[model samples]
Target: MANNNVSAICSCCSEMDGIFSRLLILTSSITRRLIEFFEDILLRDVNRLLRDSEINSYGQSQTSATYASSSRDCNSDTSIAFLDRNASDLDDHHSLTNSGLEIVNRNYHRGVRFIFKGLMLPLYCFEFAWGSVIASWRCSCYHMRCMQANMQSFVSRIVKTLHGSSDDIGWLQSAPGMAPVEDGSARFVELLQGIRNGLHKLPDSFVYLLIPGLFSNLGPLYFVSTKRFFSKMGLACHIAKIHSEASVEQNAWELKQYIEELYWGSGKRVMLLGHSKGGVDAAAALSIYSEELRDKVAGLALVQSPYGGTPIASDILREGQVADKETRRIMEFLICKLIKGDIRALEDLTYEKRKEFVGAHKLPENIPIISFHSEASVAPGVIATLSHIAHAELPWLPQFPGEDRENDDFALAARKVPVVFPVSAAMALSALHLQLRYGEKSDGLVTCRDAEVPGSIVVKPERKLDHSWMVYSSWKKDPEDSSEVDACEMCEALLTMLVELGEERSN
Candidate 1:
């Protein structure tokens, strides 16, 4: 009977070992597959741009020659002036096209990083589990604590590496011929770079933080993708790279600690900025931090943040879509690897709870809070123009139309027509929802009305700057119309506001 029991125990142990080995193999294969997929997507997109550039070179030469010939009939002085102006305009157009292509390339690279990170999720989990198992086996409290600390350091390194790689990807994807625009045409890029430079100069005054929204880890990538534009404008920005799956309170606490370190007990004001769920984090931190710490805040900028809540989040939660085992696993994997924190997972929290976390939180009345949003519009004419240009056919174009012609009034008007089927459908639904719901002003993801805060100065430029482009600037069409501004100009506006506010306070 003892011999039989020993044999049975051995068999059970063998079965368990086999299962563990199989899981490891499966995990390895999945990670490899995801990496390959990401690489393929990035390579294909980059290759396409190289091909388009060749095609565009031929077309630009032809256009330039035509413009030169067309101006021959005018008076010599007038013709000279016309030729210079025409050349400048062409240069601007080329620059804009190149910028757009750079953005496309950046997106592809970012997707690759996101997928690669997603694959790392299972490994991260396994590492955590294996460490826990070893600590349990040894039954050493000190060893367990050391292992936990090691795990924290390891995770921090992973997050930092991911953020750095993501930023490098953006810088690598920037167009080779694209020069920093010194003129007004490059205002937005210049402004963003200026902000970055300004922040770097006053490192003591800035505390870089991350605010994440629901979905995946795309938020950081989204920021990284636009980093070039911002860098060009002068903003030396960095992401905290905290995963979206992290609890809001935890994220807030971590950011607060980081801010404290940066401030070093000095009363220097720090700028807090976030996109989507990150915005929620900024608000939460401001709300919960000690009053003395709150006084250290100089400004809060939120990009496409839904302080109220996003309808998409409500839909995902209501449908129990996030509850599927496979879906949750996939999201967890991605969140661990690609994203910083999980905002949607907080779906368990009541709307009131979320509101209390984000909305009820108030900064000092003196602290500047600036909010920005994108209005969806479709301009067929601009689309047609972009379609004709071989190099400007960006992957994100169809979804984000008004971006290319952000400074053109006519383009803005054209966008109001609803060109794409999805946008048209969304527009129709939005109209009905607005009528039924009464005064609801959302652009599908966020409401325009809710995007605003009381006493906060809102700058709604006439151009239909999409959610992403609000931070970056596009070329303006009409030279005379100064109303439509880009990111660089926006930076100047912000500075002007600050100067004016400072003067008022002194008075």
Candidate 2:
């Protein structure tokens, strides 16, 4: 589809079949890109021909008086301004097509063109029957592809979790131009020096409390090699012992109590360095801690944490994999009972739940909070965009039987772009679903926008890291897998910032 075209929601259906469940999205992506190839070629040439013919006719002498302007097809034609990839072209609001006939993609079944350039096929009595058949087939294909893709994805993740190896697989690869990063220390040496200078007046007794993320209970495993680097800076860093998969509210309350009596009541403030859910929990605890207790809590440095709940949590919790309906229930039972995790941990991370929590509790005043967020998906070819929500919501799409036409407006559709790598067919569905829900690209787990807080200072030169890569260096096979190392340095800087801010407030 052209850059000017907007996406619409699909009307594809699903049958109770297994093969279609997984391959449908992959198939859909292939089909949609093929359609784009054809459309891009045909549309561009047609417009060029029309534009040239008009120019030729305009140059003819006495063309206006002798050749009646009323007879010219210009009035019936819609002018198309061929768009380009420059940032300025995004502002083109022209909604007209060359011949004034709307073009629909065979796969996406959506888009708007200012100039009509296709065959003037006359509609007959078969229009209803044809549309009905197409809609039915679309729905069926969609469901099957989703099912197959998800099943394969779930199995792959399980295999990876148990065996700790799957890099040999042909489907997954480091995205083009995404090589493993060299050691992170080199990137932040200048920044670290500047921070050290600014915070040189800090007291020697302040402690750095490292709060690990969900399922991160093993001491400093999430922070990887960065803890040792901090110890060298004369900071006493300790990992908090809260249950990994517990509710944020519960963990926050518990963490609050632990912090209040920490350091044998010596009154040294605890600088919190939290990752993922740990970050969210720390923020919640800071909101509830009393002024005296809150005073002891120095600052917060949240890394790759979802301040807004991730849609993946809701999708997995509420709607299990199409191929495995019991995956959610079974995982909950096993993790909560065997691993001793709180069953409601997933629930606490829902968007609605977190919004309610933030609304109910206010953060402590004058506490310096620095946040770092990351959102990245493999930038695959046409296939990547197909799975994205933007492509799924084109306005020219056939409406589902259950669609609310009143809410389906062309203006609300997202612009389509072929970006993001669908790691698996299952991830394709996730990418597609997320994009449809939020109309934004995401790092398989969380949208970048959701990871940030309103008042926090974001690190410059934002890292293009993914959620899992923030902690585990082994998520990808590439050599540049040390974002967690960089993040640790960022946390150290924030810790220093907190001490500097505290001194300024005290004086």
Candidate 3:
């Protein structure tokens, strides 16, 4: 997997580009702040004489407070406001996730391939002498451990969701985390069969619109292959032809146009099933578009959608690489281009950006949203030996900052405004930026906390389900591959449920 070719694109080269861009933002921020600082000093000196003459004309302290309050308001509206991230909040050395991360970090060494670095001698020797067997062994060992500790739970929850007899699923809609997700595997299969029957027997009137994620139309390539798969099951599903790489607003507008232009039977409501960013974009469309369009939509099934945006978005914004180079190019070709030339798209996926969009728009009051989010990870893996550790030991990644709130007034005067906020190195970035709240449970993209959209029926976090696996390669052909989780069967079941829900709502 090492890109050692002399002319091939390098991750470090991308990293350097990211560093350069951040520096630009930092420079501009610094220049602006310095100008303001000098302006304040001059104004203070000039106002001293006036203050001395007037004696009680609006006390300086009071004026300062008024200005500060206004500045806070403006800052909240326009900028990303960060909660005080204490050092205590990080480095959860007591969990399996951390341990797994450490294992990966310790042995799976990254050799810099760029000739410009002029530092290939050591890694080359290691690769040539040992034939890279040591590195391979280290990676295999860690992956094995991840499987050993996590596979049973993963198979039970995710695997059982498909083939097992149990119906217990962690439901987020209510207080009870564990509830019946299905009657049984047999009943679910019957439901799947029923959906197929209905679709085969039904007329053109029955249409379920599938909206793909970021950088997609029809869905991701893997998702696209499943297109005729849903149709054969008896539902007339059409992929919403949306510009997958556009901002949510842009995508929404396009969707609004598509929905409005559609020819539907009298009183026929359309079913919308959006995956990943498509779900968020669909919500945005319904939120901002006309009520007429809202009336046409039956219900939305958001599958593994990031309604609150992923922390990875922040990582990409501060870093130059987007999903690595090859995957990035595939995304570009498949979805009208992704992050290489389009940084704004990445910016739009940041937590702050999503928050702004959600806050500004109102979710329609009547339409039902059936949202399912799945994340599989354990936090504090660094110290998994500590059995007493509670899942909540690490706070949830701050999605809208509800439970991890700091006092708004905490050391307000002493806080230094950051001219250039720092970003962590990308090597173990996920391990470091993980949310303690969800116990670092993520789909390799969105945290479960962030995925849970308020005022919707939600499936509580499902283990063994990573971001890519949810839509692409849920089950590995080889058991040796630690990353795979059997998600395809579970996903098909969810779609059947959505079709059933849509049928009920449409009628």
Which prediction has the highest lDDT against the true structure?
A: 2
User: If the candidates were sorted by their TM-score against the true structure, best first, what order would they fall in?
Assistant: 2, 3, 1
What is the model-wide C-alpha lDDT for candidate 2? 0.57
Per-residue accuracy of model 2 over 78-159 as CA lDDT, tens digit each: 2121112221332231233333324423222333221111221222223445556766867765676677677778877665
Candidate 3 lDDT, 17-135, residue by residue in tens: 56755665675577556655755575565456444634443355346545655667656533232212211222232244446545644333232123312443564454455535544
In candidate 2, stretches whose alpha carbon ends up further than 4 angstroms from where it belongs are 1-203, 218-220, 263-266, 319-328, 377-437, 472-485, 503-507
TM-score for each model = 0.42, 0.47, 0.44
How many clashes show up in model 2? 40
Can you give the lDDT of residue 261 in candidate 2?
A: 64
Where is model 1 poorest over a 10-residue stretch in terms of lDDT? 386-395
Query: By summed lDDT, which 10 consecutive residues of candidate 2 come out lowest?
Result: 164-173
Question: Who wins the TM-score comparison?
Answer: 2
User: What TM-score does candidate 1 reach?
Assistant: 0.42
